[model samples]
Target chain A: MKLSIENLNSFYGSVQVLRELTLHVNTGEVLCLLGRNGAGKTTILKSIMGLVEHNGSIMLGDCEISGLGAHEIPRKGIGYVPQGRRLFAELTVKENLQIGMLIKGEDSHSLDRIFKLFPVLKERLKQESGTLSGGEQQMLAMARALCLQPGVLLLDEPTEGLMPSMIASIRDVVLKLREQGVGILLVEQRIDAVLPVANRVAFIENGYVKAEMERDELANEPDLMRHYVGI
Target chain B: MDFGPFLFLATLEGLVQAAVLCLIALGLSLVFGVMRVVNVAHGEFYMLGAVLAWWITGWFAGNPAIGFVAAIIIGPLLVGVIAYFVERLILRKVEYDPEATIVATIGILYIVQQLVLITFGPDARPVDTPFYFLIEFPWFGYSGYKLLVICAAIMLLLAVWYVITRTRLGLVMRATQYDRETAQNFGIAVNQVYAIVFATGAGLAAVAAVLIVPIQQAHYLMGRDPLLLSFIVVIIGGLGSIRGTLVAALIIGLSDGIISVFFSPTLAKMVSTLLVAMVLVFKPEGLFGSRSQL
Candidate 1:
């Protein structure tokens, strides 16, 4: 399903973080949000997940999801893997996965797919999540969200501190999700990682969408990143 | 008169105290751990359970055992329902803000205490034990009912442990305790979880009171000691650590029983308070809690 946001203004208390930013991700396409720190890229994802106060139309295939409670939003076929992984640290890997599956509301046989993607998670199922390595934790985070089998997935900085090999695997997973027809909105700092997976790049500056371009066109222009993202 | 019998008696009394205190403190610790709010009225829920047990048992004039059995089953359930409303109305309204909830629960404490004093007539009422069989020891006779209380507490603790470790509902609670926002993101009804947890906490406190009312009189002010002791247990055990709570309860309960029996009740309270101060000074996160948890 298509996910669309129009005239979305989000705020944290009195500090307005997102302006009238408009964006959308079509089915089976990965829309990457590229921006510097304090550019409100993360806020955009939070607003769509109804985790922040916002005034906007967040339409998931014409169903407005803005103003919904955070607990209610995930049940609408959207899975969010927030920054820092945010796993229940004390809980075991199996229990962490169980929380995600609880949202799916049924045993949808997604565990097999998850295990196939991250075999290490199956090995460490009984191990505490906090004890997992950073890469394993990220994989578990992605695997936890994937348990939802969501129509749209919002990932915030999934490759923030990963090794190059792990980043490549993340890219492969993103591409695979796109192939499975899951619309993805990925927030990333590395252009190299975004290039292969993101179909379209939405350049955000100061809570506003400054520019949008096809991934190929953006890859061709090196100065565009220097201008909008300052990298 | 020998030291062996006295020590054995003290140990037995301590075990009984630890059994009931663990149940009460577990509730307090769970509520504090998950909701991040100090339930100042936790003791009042305990008092209410004892008072309710007395009131409910007064109905069956023929056999006190029949009423005692009914009190054991119904007392905590009623307290849980009341606690559910209190959480939804007062705690939820305050947004579970730590400071606000403390004030709100203090208000709940006074309201409940005063209401009990007015209706229950400020008397230290007693409930009959479910059974009156005594276990004859070498030197003295011990109440079989007290031993039963210890067994019941163990069983309840085991059930609670099983639920938290092996059940989906328990996983949901732990997830909420870890990160409320993330839990909500996973479609866990966080507010509902808060209500359930708060009620369950109060229910546990009430159960402790119901079990102990047979031994101790149900006084409006009876909540004070259990409240203080359980708080000590929760803090000493490490705020949210259930394992720590149980261990701390045994230590505190046995010490209280032995000290009160040997020296004086006031001295026992002072010693426990001193221990709390020492724990706070030495280990702020508590004995079992990690530094990061604080």
Candidate 2:
């Protein structure tokens, strides 16, 4: 299944954030959205998930999901790991995962898969999610999303503020999910992190898609990174 | 009267007061916790419960028990239905904005109060106790119905606790309470949850009122004390904290009851108001609430 957005225009109040932006992530591919701050990378993902006011179309497989309620959008097999890992802080880790399972009407089998992916969650299952370390919290957030068994996963800044080891683990999870045929739409600050997992990169500027390149094209054109991302 | 028996009487009165207040405050806390909106009309719902109980019980002229049982079952249901419509029509229109909801609920409060006043009249009508039994204490006899109220409140609280902690519906509610947007991300219909929660909150208040109407009277203005006391309890317990509401209710209710019997009702209110000020200044998170922003 493919996730596609065409001529998307999103606004916050009267101020427009995404102006005629278009992007797509193919099945079994990791498409990284690269941009400077305020370039509307996060807004695109939010618009896809119906979390923002947007014009134009978001199609998941054959279904048009542009105007669906935010809650309804997720049940359409599009899992979203929002920025800042908005885990239910007071709920226990087990309860957090239970919510994910309950969302998709999945049984404990999905939980077993998640446990295989991140064993640390099982150990701290009884602990409150708020008390988890940053890495653990991030993992729990991803695990919660993955419980949906979504075909298209929207991950915003998954490895932000994480230790190098934790970042590597997150990168591996992304790669694993990609291998499982989940279309991953990722936004990350680390170019090095993107290089390993991203099959294609789209440069966004001023709420528009400025350029697009394959992974090899990005590896060769190092100056493109400095120009678009200011790194 | 001996001091021991006097004290015992005060304690019993306090327990009954606390039982009723706990149910009322828990509803307020639940509304605040789930929706983050202050429901000023909560007290009116309580008043409606009492009035409805009186109205429903009037049908069973021969047996007060049948009438009382019918009142208990029908009163809260009617209140819940009314509340559900109120939420869907009014609160949802405002998008649950904090300030707008306050004003809206205030409107609802007056509308409900006036409707009752117009129809039920302004009389302080009394509902008969379902059963006329007394528990024989060593010193004196106590009303068994009052003790039954305490037990009913406990059972209801436990049922609420189980639903919140052990059921999927409770998980969804807690998840929505924790983070609204994320709950949306995981396919939880937050708006629908809000409507259900608002109704449930009102229903809880109604249940409390129905339970207490026999002890007190079904007066349109009776919501005033319970509302103020519930506010004080909610604030002292911590906004949106169930355990906090329970603990605060006990503290305030017992103190008010004991003080009222010994001193004056005015002193009890004053003491509780002063305690609210102290709690706000010293521990705004409440005695049982986590140190999080209210």
Note the DockQ of each predicted structure: 0.79, 0.76
Residue range B34-56, candidate 1, lDDT tens digits: 88989999999999999999999
lDDT for each residue of candidate 2 in A1-231, tens digit (9 for 90 to 100): 799899999999999999988888899999999989999999999899888899998999999999999999988999989899998888889988888877667587888999989999999999999999999999999999998889999999998899999999999999999999999999988878766999999999889999998988876877878989887
Q: Evaluate residue B32 in candidate 2 and report its C-alpha lDDT on the 0 to 100 scale.
A: 90
Q: Report the Cα lDDT for residue A36, model 1.
A: 90
Output the worst ten-in-a-row residue range by lDDT, candidate 2 chain B: B285-294
> For this target, which candidate reaches the highest DockQ against the unseen true structure?
1
Output the number of the lDDT-best candidate. Answer: 2
TM-score of chain B of 1: 0.97
Task: Give the runs in model 2 whose Cα sits over 4 Å from its true position.
Answer: B291-294
What tens digits encode model 1's per-residue C-alpha lDDT throughout A131-203? 9999999999999999888999999999989999999988888888999999999998887877789899999
Task: Give the clashing pairs for model 1.
Answer: none
Model 1 alpha-carbon drift over 4 Å, by segment: A105-108, B291-294
